[model samples]
Target: MSESKRMDPFTGEKVEVDGVYENEAGQEEELHRGDAFPADLILGNTEWKLTEMSFDNHHEGRTDERLVPKEKDIDKQGKIDSPRRQMDRGKK
Candidate 1:
């Protein structure tokens, strides 16, 4: 087993890692996007190594703006946002 330190992007802390790790697993993934990706490896622990990537530009990540409610739509507690809550509020 090998030992290494990696910076945690979320917590901004030093993370200690043990075992054989792929330090440059997705090195090409940063340079590539969607279908234009260069070959990158998604290594697994003694199980697999994924060197091929297939991407579809037709189905990108997008959240419908209609699904997102405005800040005014949600009350202070954020629980009174839906139509059901509006009805409940009218009863009160």
Candidate 2:
């Protein structure tokens, strides 16, 4: 007989279901967005186990902005040494 493979819940792709992995705290470790299919079977007390695998195009839903939450806003005012900050004391 042949065994059927299950799909990954997050990616909706066919994946091979394996045994559960644990962590130091005995809690289940979460899979990140960029995590690859057929995750590594990590052993610890947190119960982190590689559940399944995913397709190549799994991160279609994630937005570019989401990947980089915030960026340094450019200063449009220019440098402080510019004429803007200089006081016109001579005119007074």
Candidate 3:
């Protein structure tokens, strides 16, 4: 049998391909290209492996600003405001 393509993706990493990914716990998630891998609430960070490729041709390889990663915003204090940090701003 041919070797299966395996990916080493971590939480917060950009999804390089549109496909179904399986984590170490055997949990599967369908992620589109350019989307960030989400952290597992219970397991925290886990490695992801691409299991299946998506054949959807709706976009036809077109790039979307909403789907791609954005530049980090810097606050007045010169601190980079990441998505997680922005969400935690009011908690502190």
Candidate 4:
């Protein structure tokens, strides 16, 4: 048996592992866009070392202008915004 480790749902591009405990078995998964990645590793009890690791780019992040509502579109609570179109003056 070993101590439990906590990890963030999202992973960064870089990772630094400290040490592994004995009989440590776990699985780490990173989801991005429409892609799915699964990773499995067995941690050693000796020293802090990265045994089995992998990186996957799911590319699930995005910004859709259509999803954004206008100022008036939303109520006072700010839940939604109005869809009024605001025209910008032509400038050189």
List, residue by residue over 45-89, the lDDT tens digit for candidate 1. 222122444444426556555555566764444444466655343
For each candidate, what TM-score against the reference? 0.19, 0.17, 0.53, 0.19
Computed on alpha carbons, the lDDT of every model, listed in order, comes to 0.34, 0.40, 0.78, 0.35
- Is 1 or 4 the stronger prediction by lDDT? 4
What's the CA error at residue 71 for candidate 4, in Å?
1.4
Candidate 2: 10-residue stretch with minimal lDDT: 7-16
Q: 40, model 1: CA deviation in Å? A: 8.7
| Candidate 3 lDDT by residue in tens digits, 1-92 | 34566548898899999999988888999999899988888898988988989876546667654444456633333433355544354555
| Model 4 lDDT on a 0 to 1 scale | 0.35
Taking the tens digit of each residue's C-alpha lDDT, what string does model 4 give over 1-92?
Answer: 34367433222223343222112244323333333222334332212223444333324545455566555664444334444444456984
Candidate 2 lDDT over residue span 1-92, tens digit each = 33355422332223234334233434444444544333333531122336444444547856454334244636533334355665568655
Q: In candidate 4, how many clashes are counted? A: 12
CA RMSD of each candidate after superposition: 13.8, 17.8, 16.0, 15.5
Stretches off by above 4 angstroms in model 4 are 1-24, 30-60, 72-92
Residue 3: error of model 3 in Å?
Answer: 10
Candidate that would win on TM-score? 3
> Which pairs of residues have clashing backbones in candidate 3?
none
